[model samples]
Target: MTTALVPPLAACAPVGVFDSGVGGLSVLLEIRCQLPAERLIYVADSGHAPYGDKPPAYVQARAEHILAQLRRAGCKAVVVACNTVTGLSIQALRERHPDWPIVAIEPAVKPAVALTRSGIVGVLATRNTVASPGLARLIAAHAAGVRVLPQACPGWVERVERGELDGPETEAAVAQQVRPLLAVGADVLVLGCTHYPFLRPVIERVAGPSVIVLDPAPAVARELARRLAQAGLAAPGPAPGDVAFWTSGDLAQTQRVIALLWGQAVQPQRLPDDPA
Candidate 1:
C-alpha cells in the first residue's frame, strides 16, 4: 500500500532532478552531456539549504515533497542529486514511490578506494553525509584494509551557493580540509558532496599534483542513461534538450548561482507555495 508508480510520461516529458541547492548542477551537467535529447526539470530546495546538517526527518520530508512536485509535473524519471538525502533516505524514497526509476547519487568511495595507490582514501562531504550509516557501510564493504578518512566540509556548500569558487578564504578552506588527508598518504580524494565538484579547482590546488580528485557525476550520468533505457523512458534524440529550473530561494540569487555553476544564463521558474 505505498504509492505505486504512475504510467510513463511522454518521451519528451522532462526528467526531474533535485538537490538541496545548486550543487546538483554538477550532476545535471553530466546528464545533459550524456542525454542531450531529454529535457530537464531541476529544483533547488534553497529555502532549506544545506540538508547536510538537518535532522534525517527534515531532509526526508523535504525530499518527499520535492518528488511529489516532480511527479505532478509529468516527469518521466527523477534523479536525487543530494548525497545527504540519498544516503539517509533512498530506501524510504523507493518505498514511497514503488516503481519510479529514481537515480540517486552517493559519495564516490568505491572508485576512490579502487583508484588509491597509497591505500588511503579521503572523502569530503557534509556533516550528515559523513555520519551517514550508508557511507559507513559502503566503506566497510568496499574499502577493505584501506584507510578511509571522512572530512566534514562545513562551509563549502554555502560558498558555492554564493558563487565563490576560488578566493583567498575559499583556498584557505580547501587547504584546511585537504592538507591533513594528503599528509596522511591519501592519494585519492572523493568529492562526497555535489557542491564540492564545483570547487574542484581550489581542491586540486590544495591537494597538489599527486592527489586524484574524483566526482561521481559521470558514473551517475551513465547509470541514469541505463535506467532510462531499461525503463523505455529515454527521450528521442538528435534534437537538443532544454532545461527548466525552479527554486524555493530568492529567485534572483538562485538564478545568479545557477548561471555561474551551470555555465549559462537560465530563467528559473518559481514554485507555488504550499499551504500545508
Candidate 2:
C-alpha cells in the first residue's frame, strides 16, 4: 500500500497584511525578510487612500471591510500595518474578533526614549496618529523624562502615496517639519507613520548626520513573530514563501507602487469595491 506524504509546515496559508495605501509595503517587506518561510497576502486599500486625514469613523469602517475580506481569504492572522488604523480602530477589531491574531503598529516612542542621548526625540506622523489618545497614553507611560515633540505633516502621506520619494518639494517639506525639532535638541527622530519611512532620505538630509532615524517596522515584525510562536502558528523555516497582492484601486498604479516599494513586480488582483 502506498502512503501519503505530508506537506512541510512552512507551506502553510499566507498571513494577511493591509494598509490604507502603499505605505504598508514597508511593514510587509520587513515581515517577509524576517519570516521568509511564511507566505504573505497584501491588500492596498487605495480606494480610500491616505487614511491619515480621514474621519475616525470612516477609517474604522474601511478597516472593518479590509479585515473581513482578509478573513475570507483564509489568512492565519492579520496585521494592521497602518499606524492611523492601529491607533484609531484596533481595539474595536480585537473586541469583534477576539480569537483572531491581530498585530498593530504604534510609534516607537519607548525605543526612541531608550536610545536618545539628547533626551529629546522628534516624531513625524500623520495628523490622526499625532492626535491619538492612544499615542498620548503610550508617551505618558514609556517616554517619562524624555522630551517628545510631535509634528503632523498635513500632506506628507498624500505625497508619499503618489510615489514622491525625494524632490525639491519633499526636501522643503522635510526641512520645514524637522527644523523646529532639531533646534530644540532632538537627537533622534521616530518615523511614527508607515509612509514616513519612504521619505527617510529627505528627512535625513534635513536632520543631518548628527540625528538618528528609527523605523518601527522591524520591531513590529519581531512582535508578530513572538505572537505567532506563542500561538503555535509559526511557520517552520528553510524555503522562501509566495506573496499575493490585491488592490481596491487602479491595479496598474498599485502594481507599480508595489514594485517600487518591494523591488519585485506585483500583479495585483482587483477586489470588489463593495465586497459582500
Candidate 3:
C-alpha cells in the first residue's frame, strides 16, 4: 500500500503560497478574503522572474525547490500561484507529492468559452504558458467549437513587477496585444497570468464596456477552501490571520512593489540562494 506523502498537519498550520514573483499576491488577496482565519506564508522566486520564457525543465526545478522550502516551513498545504508553473509543472508536482493538498491556478479558458457571446475568447499570458501542453489540452477539452486565441504578452509581466500599472508605457504595451484580439471579435478576455490582473483596469478601459475580462484568482481561492475543508486543514478561529513574505529577488524592490500591489507596506524577508 502507498503511504501518504505528507502526514496531515494541524488546522492552524500556515498555508504556503509561491510564484515566480509578486504576481501571486493577486491570488493571495483572494485567499485572505475567503479564509481570513488562516495564516499565510508567501515566497517570491523573483530572481528567476518571468517563468513564461523559461524551459519546462527549468521551471519545474525552481518549483520543486520552492515547494521544498515551503514544506520545511511547516506549511499545511501549498498554492502554486503562477500559471506558467501550473501549466507546465502541476502534474509532476502532484505526482511527486500525492495527498499533500496542493491547489493550482490555470487560465479561465473554460469559463470564457462558455460566456462569450461572440464565440471568441482571447487569452493573455506569458510565452511559455501560451505554448504549454497543459493549456493546449485545457482548450481542447473545454473549448470545443469555440475560437480560442492565445496571445502572449511579452513584457507585460515585467511592467507589473515594476509596479507600472497605469502609465503611458504600460498602456501602449497593453494596447499592442489587446487591439488585435478585439479586432478579431473576441468579446471575452482571460487573464491567463497572475500579474495581468494588476493591469486589469487598463485592459478593461482598452476593451471598453462590451468586453468581459476574467481572472482565475477567485476561483483558485474557492478551490483552496474546498481542498482545505476536505482535508480538515482549514484554520479554526475567526481572528484575522497574519502573513509573512520571502523573496529571492532584491528585497527593497520587492518590498516596494509588494506594497503597491498588496495595498499596504510590507517588508519581505530574503530567501537565500541556497537555503539550509
Candidate 4:
C-alpha cells in the first residue's frame, strides 16, 4: 500500500512518483534538481519491497493500486521510478491512461554500449528487469557489437532500504556483483536499478575509477520536464516547491531513511491500505 496526494488543478498539485521501495529516491533527487518549482509526492512500497522477484501479475496489481491512488489524488502526471515496473507495465499503463503523461526509467544500454571503450558493458538490476522482454528488446536494439552482461544484485535494494550503504557487508555485497562484470572486461556499468545509484561509491571502489557508472535517473527527470511542458502541466513557481513522502512500511523507519536518502529531513505519512 503506497499512495500520493494530488491537489486540485488550480492548486499546488504535486507530481506523483512511486517505486518498490526507497530506491526511487535517486530518481526523486533528479526530478527535484531539474524541476525545482514543481511539488512531488513519492511512494515507497516498502511493505512489499523488492518487486523484482514477484510474478508479473502481482507486481502489476500492486503498481495499479498505487497509480489508482495517485490518479484519485488528481495527479497531472506520474513517474514510474521502478525499472522493473517500467519494463513490465509501461505500455499497459499508457493504454489505460491515454491522457496522463507517464515517464519511466529504463536501463541505459544504448549509452553504455556507446561509452564502453572495451566494447563490454554491465547492467546491475533486479531479477525481473534483467529477465524482462522489454530489457531483452533494449539489448537487441542497442547492444550490437558490444557485450552486455546483466547481473541481478539480489539484496541490493533491501540494503538501500535499510540504509546499509558502505560497511563490510555492503562492501561484500557490491564486490560480489561487480567483480564478475569487471572480470568480463565491462568498462561501463549501467545502474539498471534506481537503488544501485546509492551504492555508487562502493561500486566505484570495487570496480576502480576507470570504470564509468551511469545512472538513468537524471535522464528520466529531464524527460518528465519535457513531457510536463508538452502537457502544459509544469508547475508555476519561483518559490521552492514542497515534497511529500508515503510508505507502506513502518512510518517512523520510512521517515528516518527517507530523510537520510533525500539529503534533508522528511516526514512520511502512512499509505492507507486500498479497498479489498
**Candidate that would win on lDDT:** 3
Candidates by lDDT, descending order: 3, 1, 4, 2
- Model 1, position 220, has a per-residue lDDT of 92
Q: lDDT tens string, model 3, 197-249?
A: 99999999999999999999999999999988888788887998899999988
Judged by whole-model lDDT over C-alpha atoms, candidate 4 comes out at 0.89
Indicate the residue-level lDDT of 151 in model 4: 93
Clashing pairs in 3: none
Evaluated against the true structure, the overall lDDT of model 2 is: 0.85
lDDT for position 38 in model 3: 92
Model 3, global lDDT: 0.91
TM-score for each predicted model, relative to the true structure: 0.96, 0.93, 0.96, 0.95
Better structure of 1 and 2 per lDDT: 1
Candidate 1 differs from the real structure by a C-alpha RMSD in angstroms, to one decimal, of 1.6
Tens digit per residue, CA lDDT, model 2, 1-276: 212212334227678999988899889999998998888998888878888889999999999888878777777778999999988888899988887789998889999999999999998888988888778888999998999998888788778777888899889888888999999999999998888889998899899999999999998899889877777777776788889988887888888877888897878998645553
Candidate 4 regions exceeding 4 Å error are 1-12
lDDT of 3 at 130: 93
State the lDDT of candidate 1 residue by residue for 1-276, as single tens digits: 534444344667789999999999999999999899989999998878899999999999999889888988888889999999888999999888877789999998888888989999999999999999889988998999899999999999999989999999999998889998888899999999999999999999888898899999999999999988887778877898989999988899999999988889999887656323
108-148 per-residue lDDT for model 4 (tens digits): 99999999999999999999999998799999999989989
lDDT of 3 at 234: 85
TM-score of predicted structure 1: 0.96
